[model samples]
Target: MQKREALEFDILFVGAGPANLASAIHLQRLLKRHNATAANPLEPSIAVIEKGRYAGAHLLSGALLDPRALDEFFPDYRAKGCPVEATVSKESIWFLQSKRKFAVPFIPEPFSNKNSLIVSLSRLGAWMAEQAENEGVQLFDNTAASAPFMENGKLTGIITDDKGIGKDGNSKTNFEPGLLLKAKAIVIGEGSDGSLTRQLSMHFPSISAAQRYETGVKETWEIPEERITAGEVHHTFGFPLESDVYGGGWLYAFSPTLVSVGCISSVGHDSPVCDPHLNLQRFKLHPLIANILKSGKMVESGARTITSGGLDAMPPLCGPGYLLTGESAGMVNMQRHKGIHLAMKSGTIAAETLFEALLHNDFSTGRLKSSEERFRNSWAWEELHAARNYRKAFDKGLYSGLVQAGLQLGIPGLSLKTTQLTLPGFTETPSFNPKKKKIALPVIPEFRADGMRTFSKERSLFSSGVMHEENQPCHLVIKREDIAEICLKKCKKEFANPCQHFCPAGVYEITTEPVPALKLNPSNCLHCKTCEIADPYGIITWTTPEGGGGPGYKLS
Candidate 1:
């Protein structure tokens, strides 16, 4: 083993996504203000380490920015050359039938993104990295933080993933041991299903409910000029999905030629065999969506899961020496279908709490808990409180969920009656239905990709620009071969893998002609981590790939 490098800081952040950048930037500002006013000024060191090759390589989202939090983060954002694709000017919602659609004139308050910006989250994240660096925050890209360091159920810091190791479980010539990053306070902002956050949970049982999630698959394309009006955000439900399935489709035409088309499906739905990626593909086949996307040229495609557990899913804000923020902390509010601003807000609150802790030279859980009060007192709390039951209402399916949503909207204090989800232990809720399991085995019609608007998974994965060192250990691991057998038994077939369905990247497939077993194409992964979240058997574990071995955001 090589002698690993060590680093120390007053504050350390893992994952350089929106939350990390936002919080670091806010902290810097606070530090600057304090230094200017205080007789005894102090300069605190701040550091951020990211798993992505660059800041935005792995950042993907439907990306409708509710600028409320962004405005607070950078009051003069537009002046800072922030990338705002277009200010939403028009919005529409529709309920679709197999061959028909009806426009609903009523735009929900959440979708009423009047001045909200339709922008690429990748662009926004990259921009924040630049801004954070300008504020003197140390930024390290292509560095993966593997796990948190916990001592007696308290976080002391993090340990980064080992580098330059070979597939044979031995160190190579260029081997480097993982770095130990110790800090007075640690901020976890690794986005959805963060690995370190999961690691910490092992030492300290989850303080809040485990998250319920919805997976989204999207394709970016340059649509025909005449068909789209820039800044138009259109959403639709029904069609493509069975009555029992909870899912929906969206189209964000942010420019005359640039548009995003996607589908989101509940991970805990009753249909275990239903394929979200296939559902997204089937969504484009609908006449209503087919018309707009038919003549477009494909640009990029990817998939990711969003937190839907709302306020109920959020874990405790702080541990002894650590605090959780962003999706890692379950800040995404389901009702509004927007978490970009919420992520920023959570980070801002964490920053304020950390600032106070810094001044007092205290890093205990009690001191950090102040951030939770500020968060609950902020508007984020009110919005989240109302949406607390949004995802839980979906337990009965889409129609019922919508009805409950309406009642919650129209009736005062309705959500106060919401109950906590009591999920199964050892394992959790299964996203698929056993009755429909075999029947839902993804009978994708002989639909061919036209290469313009429609493309195959291989083509889409290529567009995502993901690259992995094939000879290295597979980051996507199957811990229990017995789990595979159980999955096949559930599907009632030999060598049948459920992973092939939920993975939008088509990384897992069961090949019968050769030896009748699963095959992994790890290089094509989009880094969505859906396999880790939705696998019914709870056997698939997503570890950090070789540094910079995932998708590269191109728009390269």
Candidate 2:
């Protein structure tokens, strides 16, 4: 590859989500504070890179905002326009069966959210971007940081993905190589399952400890005015998932007629039939949920993978010239199903540490290591430490997890006694063997999209506004030609090509017209990365797509 265009900054933050946005805002203030006395044009420069076509196009979350970090970030933020759609006023928990539901008499203390507000995280990211720009941070949308640029066994900066290419591995008419963005200090806040984050963590042996993941699918509905009580919050467990599977479902009435229904299926499932997409379809047909969604019109839907492991298994925060924050560093509090606040807090700490390093003319691990210690002392750290064993406790079964979690709630010290389950999600299931296992399902896993209430995968993908250039090379790579043959054999025998069942968007299919093979529809990709994590044969690798190609998620 020939040399490409390059840009330099004093500090560069990747991803335009909450964490990087918060860091850029804080760093702007620090830079301005330092240059208050003398007007130096050579002072620190801050920039943020985002893959979205716009500020909010690639962000998603169930998204109830805890105002702790926001309160600290901007005390007078209320004066500015806020994106909170509804303040959570009513909350409840329930256990549901196929035909009935029963509310838990008492809601757990940790699950309480009296002051939180329901929000579209994408909207929040746009608002934060506005705040960052006001503080003089440069924002670059339609640009994606693909991989870390390493030199001399240390980090230097990042390389953006190439702009144009074709399926034949040759440049197109609009061919353009990736650009190099250099910075003295870098911060990666690119949500869970990010491409660059994966490279940084996986390639580096000392930094790659966190590996647990969960697939989350969500849909927005426009119901009748009388159907929903605004600001209502509800969470569920037990019915949709088996006793051995670690997962749950959620519903929240964020507006007068808009409700979000979703399901989360953890990756360390014991059944070969642990299909998350089909599981959510079954969950919606349940009487309890079906009643709420009756006569409702589907608005939008999307899916994303979550990083569930916290402090105990998280990747290292600092290496040489860069610091990792947000879900990329495993900052989520799995017990509460919350992470935006913790991610923002990590950004604040990263900002403080980087500013100090820049001021002192040092970017080595020796100086950047302080950021990790600073995070360890923050409230976000305290919360994660207390709930560190929450997700891992479920490895044995739901009962063991529930018991351990219940005990830790009343007595925080019990967390020390909680055992850590370090099982990697990819190694949990077995490959297809017709004689040994039987596939279980609610509906045929191969249901076609109807574009109506019972929408098919392709129609559901349309709801997400997903797009990719037809001429671009396939992003989902299969290691060998025989792998498709194996999947085809399993499809014929028993498994029915599990990728079609697992992908929230219909990206994979088995074809027999020309020849029996596993076909890929990359244009329908939701960018969820579930196929990369859950493939039984361990052959798929999802590389970065074109610079500006993906679902344009506005309200996810």
Clash count for candidate 2 is 1
Candidate RMSDs in Å, in order, are 2.8, 3.0
How much lDDT does candidate 2 score?
Answer: 0.79
TM-score of 2: 0.93
lDDT of each: 0.79, 0.79
Candidate 2 residue lDDT tens string, 1-556? 6697989888899999888898888777777777786455226788999988888788888877788998987667778787888989898888777778899898877878788889888888999899999999899988888889887777788999897788898998888898999998889888877788778765576666646788888888888787668888888888778777788898888797888888898753223345677667777877767778888888888888888877776878888778888988888888889999888898889989988887778888899999978987889888988877787777777888788788888875264353555574443232434465554643444444344556767667878888888888899988555465667664445545667777888888887888777789998888888887766665677888886688887777
C-alpha TM-score for every candidate: 0.93, 0.93
TM-score, cand. 1 vs. native = 0.93
Off by over 4 Å in 2: 37-42, 268-272, 413-419, 424-452, 482-486, 489-496
lDDT of 1: 0.79
Residue-level lDDT for 155 in candidate 1: 84
Q: Which residue pairs of candidate 2 clash?
A: 449-456
